[model samples]
Target: MLKTTLGQWRMFRAVVEHGGFSQAGDAIHKSQSTIHHAVQKLEDSLGIKLLQVKGRKVGLTQAGELMLRRANYLLDEAAKLEAVATGLGAGTETQLKIAVDEVFPQNLLYRVLDTVSAQFPLLRIELMETVLSGAQELLEKARVDIALSPVPLANGFNEEFCQIEFLAVASPQHALHQQTQALSYEDLKSHRQIVVRDSASNSGKDVGWLGADQRWTVSHVRTSIDMISQGFGYAWLPVPAIEQELQSGLLKPLPLTQGVKRTAQLYLCFADGDRLGPAARTFIGEVRYQSESLLTAEQLSDSN
Candidate 1:
């Protein structure tokens, strides 16, 4: 059996990347002959002509192209393996399971995740989208390493993260909007309320007004918004989720004489925030960076 080493593959990759043995030698600080010898040994072990001389440059043979493509990924994973090892040596966790409130804007969440994923490509991420107090429950049960919750837990480290605007809205054609005067809390109590159910396993407490004579409870915020759009009921909806709806005048904000529309304060709570590992810390940083944009509400039709 031919002995093929990581050093041989690395030298082969450098040659492919630099386009020639001499150039690869210049880049890796080795003699041109040494680079050529290592790649030649790699080709011999694999029984293939990995490179061919094309003018003053080197071109990958068909077999060489395939091997090189695989080598790139192999090298990436090797580098990641070392990163993970070094992180482990420095007390960094290899994986982090997180639960975030679904009320948080998905676009913002995706951006934060994208940034953090690049920072720790090898770190395993287990993300759970929760509603209301679901994230709190997950953390309580030790089911997640980190959590972003709208409600603060009685214990542990809790810090204000961001606020999401919740507009009291109804379809223009709805009965509530037909009134000429602004609404009172009593006025809303008479109309049907569209409510999003909590995602917690233990059943979470209902938020906002539950005193409506008629109410509809659904599992997701989208469903509640859909019902509101259909003129079935009125509910407080996130401005970001209904940006298109608000712009198109499909959903109009209800004017409240008393409380008006609201914003919920979401918090970053960790079981042990200070003692978190590098992976968790990096995730928190990414979240904080992307969250600022989400806090600034998308322009609604009018704050009436």
Candidate 2:
């Protein structure tokens, strides 16, 4: 049996965080005497002095500082335990909100979703297709439970999800193809460029080359692809998205001196990791597993 109770540790933490017993009492809606008793009881249970009085405010002793760290870990674990219990009691979630950047492979996304839907037939998914920083923005606002984005959430948990291959390409009829030798940035600068607009309202910025004299910004990836294929303009497009066009000779890769291909690394982020229910956890695991499988297959093909 543990000598200290969770209540005691919680009160001790509140007192330390708020800087005094009265402040902690006010924060927690408890009387100062009640907070003081809990802290005193905690010190007694631990058989050590946790706080020392200095002037009007209380300060932690050397032992208190060390124990506080351990106490915080314990408290965090306890909270996670309660969250898990709550999730279990609530059963599987009826709906899940996911924000996926358009750059991620559609086939892989479909495969993961198909598997998840099979497992939870009754669950609804709100899939928000975003671009660049859009996914991260939705996660920051707590509008999505999970986000797959190249841009990671600031000071938040993230894992390398997948890599998207971007190839700079243009139509065979485009003016850039008229060059006899390898193309340079200077050669392409005179032509028009088609770019997809960033979906985020704020904190959105352009990526890759932007030196073309005339620029056309579109809202969707398909729009950019359509414009580029019809000889409207040239742009760096994702290989997975334009595979059919590339294979059929509708779009040709640019013979650039350098940077003909670029890889964008996408990350998996959660709005509140600890609060994720069973369905969300399972989906996260499946996505990771599928991405790993794809990466391994690609690596083997590259080696051969």
Candidate 3:
């Protein structure tokens, strides 16, 4: 029976990518002798000559080429198995993998994490910040236990939680800030703006202030905030995301003659609602309970 395993497959792939044992060893941070021994053992176990050695160079034999293909497939399958096991183990610890919209506040997320961890010390928490579409994809694929997304639930996933307000923000120095009345949606057309691009291919519409010309379009909210902070352009940000900036006098809300407010519904989405574990249920509860109050307070402070 072949004694070859995933590690040997990695060694084989490395040698092929790097061209020789010495180069592969250097690339993988192993000694040349160790790589040579591993390949030899793998070949011996399989009873096949995998390499043709020439003066100072090595080439793959027909068997080696075939083995390389199989090795890659094996490695990919092994990686998938590892990911599944890790996710399962995490579930047992009351751990949850959550994908959130990029515009959500980092501190608010940490607060929820802290509360959960304090309540369940053994809980494992994994948070991924992505666009609403990506978050939706993670939920649909069952890769994440829960997702906090701005997009509503029309795409078929169940919504377990939601929030109902949005904020339009700009640098304090922006021309729109000089308007004496509440800002209208049409007023946004006059200013240059930065916007978050939907990462998922099927996301039909763009969120926020979109113009015919996009000087800066980014996939991350953090990058948009950074650019806005630098005065590159104005953007409509979630209230929770720009609370501190507004409070610090770094940003100001534009006033319009006709009030133009947007109500963004934040949803907690899951692939199979019936299959949610205790950890996922608890985390979802925490998020639902906290989102409204947190967003309201931040928005109130920003308006002040």
The model with the greatest lDDT is: 2
**TM-score of every model versus the real structure:** 0.65, 0.72, 0.60
Candidate 2 vs candidate 3, TM-score winner: 2
Residue pairs with colliding backbones in model 1 are none
Clashing pairs in 2: none
Instruction: Give the per-residue lDDT of model 2 (tens digit) for 1-304.
Output: 9998989899999999998999999999999999999999888988999999889889999999999999988987787688668877888888888999998889999998989999999989899999999999998876888999999999578998788999999999998998899999898899999999889989559999999999999889999999999999999999989999999999999999998999999999985677787778888998999999989999999999
Between candidates 1 and 2, which one is better according to TM-score? Answer: 2
lDDT of 3 by residue, 36-106 (tens): 99899888888999988867778899999998888877986676577567656656445578888876667
The TM-score between candidate 2 and the true structure equals: 0.72
Error of 3 at 82 (Å): 16
Tens-place lDDT digits, model 1, residues 1-304: 5478777888898988898988999998999899889988888778889999999999999999998888877886676577556666777576788999878888888887787788888878899988999999898766887889997877677879888888889999998889999889899888999988899877858988778998888988888888899899999888778888899988999978865578998899876554467779988888887776444433332443
Q: lDDT-based ranking, best first? A: 2, 1, 3
Which ranges in model 3 have alpha carbons more than 4 Å from their true place?
1-95, 152-157, 177-190, 201-204, 292-304
Clashing pairs in 3: 181-256, 182-255, 182-256, 183-255, 183-256
Model 2 RMSD in Å is 6.8
Candidate maximizing TM-score = 2
